[model samples]
Target: MATVSQIWPFERRRCLKAHGIITLLFLDLCLQCVNGYLSSPHVGQEPPYSRDAQPVITSPVVPSPSSASPTDSDGYAAKCPSGGQCNRLPADCINCSYHHNCSYGKLASFSCKAKRGVHCTAESGKQQTNFSLSITCQFCWQLDLSQYRCSNSTSCMTVACPRKCYNATCQVLDHVHCLGKRVFQKRLYCNWTGGYKWSTALALSITLGGFGADRFYLGQWREGLGKLFSFGGLGIWTLIDVLLIGAGYVGPADGSLYI
Candidate 1:
């Protein structure tokens, strides 16, 4: 009972509604596919977003097997001795052997062992394999208050001790140790004068320095001759020598201090 125009309009509206429903369903299907692809792990790729995924745990980087051995500054691997004996003594202990008898001070030497290991380059520019470092230490000792008692008039002074000691007491040479072995034994005063006198040196310098008498007494032949020819640098050297002898600067030619 409807007209043709009304029927056509109704059909067009129904077609439009069906088209909108299909478009909506197709858009929803596309969104679901995109979501599935993003959440799932693919070949050589991880999921962009995943609720079941665990936190990534990476392992620490380890050094190669070739780099396991210890190397020196020059990248040469340190070699151990075959005899199993290494020079573990410190440099100071080794150089103590070269010091003069009754001498005590900070000494230095390059041939001494710094640590327990065979050095790639030694003082002779050759690899040292022997662990035994030849050393001939002079007789030395540390002050032991328990060994002896000091008189009331006896004075004590501090001195630079190469080895550890108590109270910095003036110790005399009693024994010697080198390369971890006792080598010598001799009871001698460390502060021995060796026949040098401070008062005599000062007196000669003040009275007859121009004549080179102090230099001659100190056993300095060259300096004595030079002073004799220069007449003590026209009295200027004489005054300086007097000061030096008085202040204990000019010592005996034998490397011993004045008494």
Candidate 2:
């Protein structure tokens, strides 16, 4: 019926329709792969995205990816990675972690199956590496981290703690992940020694001891009563006073070592 030029319109329409269908199918396949389903019926192919998302901390990485682990002037220890694959994370990771940009390059294909109580913290804030955030992990039972905090009066639930305390009296305890999956009651306390001042503790003891409270507060139950019975140990007990002032030990209620 029609001239050669016009005759091809119908055929061209069919070709266009076929192309549109193929494009739709391709996009659908890509979507499935990005969603992390990995196994889609249509494509019958494995997903290319990794679902295991790693936690990125505010600290960059040990040695900037060019050198060894970041070192302290004293070289006592090397800086550890805040979370995982540091330095390799996206630059905006700090701002992106809590939102849609968590996966960065792998966003389309990567899905995180984090357990709330073990890996993630309920407290909203940035994660820090210089200041190690201490947390009490229930361990094993749950696949995520829920609540993590430093028991110090100046709580560190959300803030990154200092790298190290100076002359200030503080406790440093090493976290132990024992039994391969359980947290143990056992903790190694870095008892303050050598030369550190405890101005706050001294002030509290001297002012509060008149009521026998200071002695009791410092884990000297017997000494507290003795001091209470003896009126601040005015003269005779001055010798014991020296001992208490210099001695560093663990707080009874808490396992933290105090100076």
Off by over 4 Å in 1: 1-190
Q: Encode model 1's per-residue lDDT on 1-259: one tens digit a residue.
A: 9999879989999999999999999999999999988777673574389744432213223232233333432332232322222343323222222323322333322133323343434455555533334433322333233432322211221112332222332223222232222222323333424578889999999888998999999999898898999999899989999998887777787655477
TM-score of each: 0.31, 0.24
> Clashing residue pairs in candidate 1, if any?
97-137
lDDT of 2 by residue, 1-259 (tens): 6888997998999999999999999999999777766444675766687645443423322222223233322332232223443222222121111222223222121112211111222234444322212222222222222222222232211111332232222222223210111332222123333222355445556566555665566566887788777876764464455346545332322323444
Task: Write down the lDDT of every candidate, Cα atoms only.
Answer: 0.52, 0.38
Please name the candidate that would achieve the greatest TM-score relative to the true structure. Answer: 1
